[model samples]
Target: MEEEITFTVPIRPDMELEVTRVASSVAEAMRLGKDKIDEIKLALIEACLNAFEHSKSKEKKVHIKIKMTDDRLEIIVRDYGVGFDPSKVKEPKIEEKLKSPRKRGWGLKIMRSLMDSVVINSHKGGTKIIMTKRR
Candidate 1:
């Protein structure tokens, strides 16, 4: 996390492509394997999706940071959205989520399963989700 790759994009559905693009660029520059690249991209997608789906800023913007090192890849997804209580995003059971009416809320769970580390910070100003995958 000493040096970071960063991007700032509108927290909107249309900006999801930019999320993939930013992550993919870092993945390729690091020579990540295909599987890792996909995983990283998906991780970023989940993060961006969370922001896009939840943030309420007038401009609808989110900021992201990616840091890679010999040991792992660290990603930070932050959104200026309506904040939520991180303590309460109960891990969605896949089976339950599949059967539920909401049919969503799986992003956090998926990200947690794929990344070695997952951390969420939220306040009135914004929400931040941080994930790291071991290399």
Candidate 2:
């Protein structure tokens, strides 16, 4: 059977940590390794930070849904805010990033690197990021 947990958090400083704590608990219960758990937490942090910083939602909140099974875990982070075109986001080069003063646009890349799969659906209404990790 699948287990699901859902909650909403206001966009504020350190709110991402609350979400990460829950993720850690669920991942631990799922028997994910320490390294995998750390990766999930980091990916989740990036997702939450992105929503907090960029969503521009009137609600000023982020919604999270976690689905877990014996062999897989899926985390969905959503925000009801103005969305942007993912295609337009430029991929940052490490070399340029090191030289640049502003070094903030790596959330998507980090999430993708840590999770098994990352899917983003964004339109004018909002954005939803579905990240999965397989055991």
Candidate 3:
């Protein structure tokens, strides 16, 4: 059997916590391991924060969808904002980050590292991130 939950949140402060609460409940219900649930929560936070800080969405909202099966979980995070080119983003290097004043830009890398799979779809209108993990 497959189960799904969908929700939308405004691009406001602390909204990511609300999303994480829902995610935690769903993951617990699915009996996901603690480490896996933590990873999911962290990745979801990064995705939501990116939308909140960078999406520049006129609607100022983020959309999330989670699909769960017997042995798999899939999450989608989306924002209707000015999209960015992933290819154009430079890979963050530790040395450069240490030297640079801005200590950010690790969201994509972190999400990919934590999730079993991550696919990004971004155009001029919006960006969508699809991430999955297997039990």
lDDT (C-alpha, whole model) for all candidates: 0.81, 0.95, 0.93
Candidate 3 per-residue lDDT, tens place, 7-115, comes to 9999889999999999889999999999999999999999899889988999999999999999888999999999999899889888999999988899999999999
Question: Candidate 1 — worst ten consecutive residues by lDDT sum?
Answer: 10-19
**Superposition error at 110 for model 3 (Å):** 0.7
Candidate 3 residue pairs that clash: none
TM-score of 3: 0.97
List candidate 3 segments past 4 Å from native.
none
Q: Give one digit per residue, the lDDT tens place, for model 1 in 18-135.
A: 8778787877877778888888778778888888887776667889888888777889998877878877887777688777888778888788887788999988888899899777
> What's the lDDT for residue 52 in model 1?
83
Measured by TM-score, how close is model 2 to the native structure?
Answer: 0.97
Tens-place lDDT per residue, model 2, 22-117, is 999999999999999999999999999999999998999999999998789999999999987888888989899899998879999999999999
TM values, all candidates: 0.87, 0.97, 0.97
The full ranking of all candidates by TM-score, starting with the best, is 2, 3, 1
